[model samples]
Each structure stands twice: as C-alpha cells, then as structure tokens.
Target: MTVSHLFMQNYTGPLMIALQYNDLFDLDSISTSTDTDALPNGRAFTFIKAVQTVNERLVEQNKSDCLLFEVILISKECSEEIKMKVDESVKHYGLEIGKFFFCKKEELINTLQSNKVKLFLSTERDDVYEALHTGIPAALLYDQADDHVLNQLKVIFSGDVIGFSEDSLDGLSEFGFSETQIETIKTAKICMKEFAVLIGQMRRRFGQENSPLCTCVLTSWGSRNVCASALKTLREWGLDVDEAFCLAGAPCSPILAVVKPHILWDGGLLNMS
Candidate 1:
C-alpha cells in the first residue's frame, strides 16, 4: 500500500511503543549476544520491520501529519547489554531509541503508566496482563507453537497487536487506533484474575497429552527456521507429533478453539486454545 491509501481517520504526533527485553531474550543464557548478520533471526530486526510497516500505514492514515515513532526498551534485567546490542541495528535502520529502563519487575507497571505510551508489546506476563486489564493497549508476542500466548493475544489485541509474520504486516496496513477508541479502552475493565482463570482452564483442557504417550522434539527459536525438519521426521515415526503445527506460525488460540490434535509440541503446547 502507498501513502494515499484510504484509512478511517488521522493520528497526530509521534506514537510511543514499549518493547520489553525479557520477553525477547533467552533468560537462561544472559551472555549470548544477538546475531545481527541475519534478520528475523534476531528480535531487533523483526521489530524494526513491524515498525516500518506500521509507519507506512501511518503515512496513509494521516497524510498531513508525518508518521513518526519513539521506541522505548523495557527490561527488568540486562538493560545495558540489550541496549548496546540492539542500538547497532536500531541505528542502522535509522530508528531512534527513546528510553531504556532496566528496573525491577514491580517497577515496570509504574514505568508504563504514562499518557505517551500508546501501545505495549511483549510476550505474556502477569504484569503485561494487568496493564491490558487496566486499559493500556498491548499485544503479546510468542514464537513457540503453543496455545497459551495465542489464546491471550486473541483476547487482548483482537485488533491491536502486531505479529512477527508477513501476514501480520499486511494486517498492520489496515488498522490504527483512534484516540476515542483508546479512551474507551482506558475505562474498559478486564480483571486479571478472570483472564488468568480462563488461561488455566484452557491449559487443563487442551494442554495435555491426548494419548498419555508420544515422542517429538520441537525447537522454540524464532519460527523454527533452524533445524526444524528433524521434528518433521519424528512426525513420521508415529511418535504422535502434530505435523499440522510443524510449519504453523506459532500457536493461535482461535485455531485451537477449532482443531484439537492428539499431540502438541514445543513449550506452548501446555496452554489451551
């Protein structure tokens, strides 16, 4: 789409987006640096691409006002390391890094309680859930083929979150939040406990072994673009692997509500659709 594409309304000023590091990084190995050479392989490149797509749509939505973004990094640990590594790619892409905070987890809620923060994106977390429940527009990003994150995103972003796939990029071209809509969201109340209970119920219902027995090993890195075929081979062994989910774009809660397979893999399988 071009800048002339028709949109519902216009958005003024630069939109601020919050990116949490813990959700993007491997918590176990804090020393592992990002492989900046190949993109999508690294979280920074994926986020940059999404931002570019959103900005392109922004141009179309508000032609008179140039679309701009201020990205802030949120982290409870390894803030300095994440900033240093991601800055290389961020500068290379010509995007500005607004602020980087590596405070305690509890402090995260207070940090994001700002009028400027239009949206928050991260993997699923209790704090993020609470933020959304309180009316802050947010989206959860997950790479594993599991129902847990997918189920939550369906409820939260129904129309707000950005995904890491090409399809999600196209979806960005179509939607932009309105101030009035955001106001409605602010007053909207979704209890955290309610969602937590739903997720637990889903887990117990679907996140279990359909057959008390199976054998399969699935990788959680990115889209499983690395060493994924091995898992597909296991699908042939009748070890009870779900080939349908092998190449699927993570787990989608909407999909889970429909198709129930005998075997689910990766870390997210424990979450119900």
Candidate 2:
C-alpha cells in the first residue's frame, strides 16, 4: 500500500506517541544524586509542554474529540524508588499522571504494538532503529540546553523513504529521473506519511493562524519536476507542510539549525549522526 493509503486509513484515530522513560528523565542523576532538587530533562519537558499546548488549542476550538493526542512513557526497568522519583518529577513539572509504564526491554516492541503507537521516541539510536525496523515511526531525541521554548511544536519530515529501510530507493538509481522513477517516488509507501496525516489533522482543526503546531518538509529533491511531484503527492495525501526546503545535494545542517524542529522524521537520510 502507498503511504497515502496508510495515512488515510489511520488518520481519524487517536495519535498515541510512546516515549522512552529514560529519554525524558535523567534516571542516573535521579538515582545517584544526593541533592533533592534534581529536575526532569528540559528537552523532554518542553516536548511534553508543546504537545499539551496543542491539546489545549484543540480543546479551545472544540476539536479535541476529532483528534486525540496521547503520550506514554515506557521504562525498561523501574524500581519503586525510581517510580517514586519519577512521580515526583511529573508533579513538579505540572504534568498529568498515569503516563508511565514499566516493561522489560525484550517486550518493548510488543508493548508499543499493543498500544498502537503512532510514534516512538528514544535517546538511544539502537532503540530508535529497532522501532523503525518494526514499522513504527521513531526518532532519536536530542538534548537542547536552550531555555527558549516555542509554544508551537515543530516537526520535520524528509521527503525520501520515511523509515530506516532503503529498499524503496533501490530503483531510483536505475531509473534516474525517468517517468517511471518519478511515479515510483511519488507513490512510494513511507512511514512519515502517518505523522504527516496527524499533523495535517491538527492544522485543519486548529486553523493555520492559531495552531500550536508547525510542520516542515525538508527534501533533497531540488529539481523542479521532482520537487513538484513530491509536493503534489503530499497535497494529494492531505498534508500541507508549513515550510519546505529543497536542499538538492547540500548539507541539511544549515536548514536544521534554523528550524530546530522538536522532532525530525528523516529515516537516516539527513545524516543526523
């Protein structure tokens, strides 16, 4: 099935995002520190706040029922002490309860699948890769020290294959820019489209002017024909990105520096390493 078809099939349901508990909390610090004032990870709190802001906007517009946003924190192992610390952190951060779970590392994938997670986030590259391989949209979380927090949640998507798999690009070298290749790229099934659909629904319900979310498409397809085709595909899929940059063969660091997206779904194409 094409990415568009997958998106159309699941866009109406709630967007369940599963985040690694270790990514959000400095477990080591909480466990080792003698100080009683340790705080949760700033980046994690910012992301949570951004999502909450969107949910608030949706409620204000009376569209919360149309698109539900849910977040779950998954921890590989949790002791009572750690759980108590985490609970304190959640309350300290002014977050809601009932969002944390303790599961074995071996059962993480099953947990995500059973919960029908639309996105998975982790600080470990291997964990993100594992989730991607399991056909779940996942991204590596990066720590940002900057104190400035944007009320709007910014998400970036790469136009190429949206997951870790590169098999979808196998024919590109053979066909080059031929019509067959262009059509293949246009119709290729990708994981990011599911995220696109979620963002699209948010944009539609919250209104572009007042929405708490911003989305961008950063692609290497700079040629007019390829870029047009990719964007046309997005439009047909009901995803209208707020910004798009055609980098051709240029480095993406410059653009990423400016965008500073809270989450990026590049499927390893952007060399985020």
Please, what is the TM-score per model?
A: 0.43, 0.81
Please report how far candidate 2 places residue 273 from its true position, in Å.
4.4
Model 1, 1-273: lDDT tens per residue? 322121212333455667776444344343554555311223333453444444454455556544355678787655555556655545655655688777787777677776356566665544445566666645444334332222221222111111123333233233453443333333322221222222222222223333211122333222443324433322222222332233233545554444322122111122222
Model 2: per-residue Cα lDDT over 194-226, one tens digit each: 667676766776666856888777776344444
Give each model's whole-structure lDDT. Answer: 0.40, 0.67
The alpha-carbon lDDT assigned to residue 59 of candidate 2 equals: 77
Runs of candidate 1 with Cα error greater than 4 angstroms are 1-11, 24-45, 60-69, 92-96, 144-273
Best by lDDT: 2
Q: List the residue pairs that clash in candidate 1.
A: 146-268
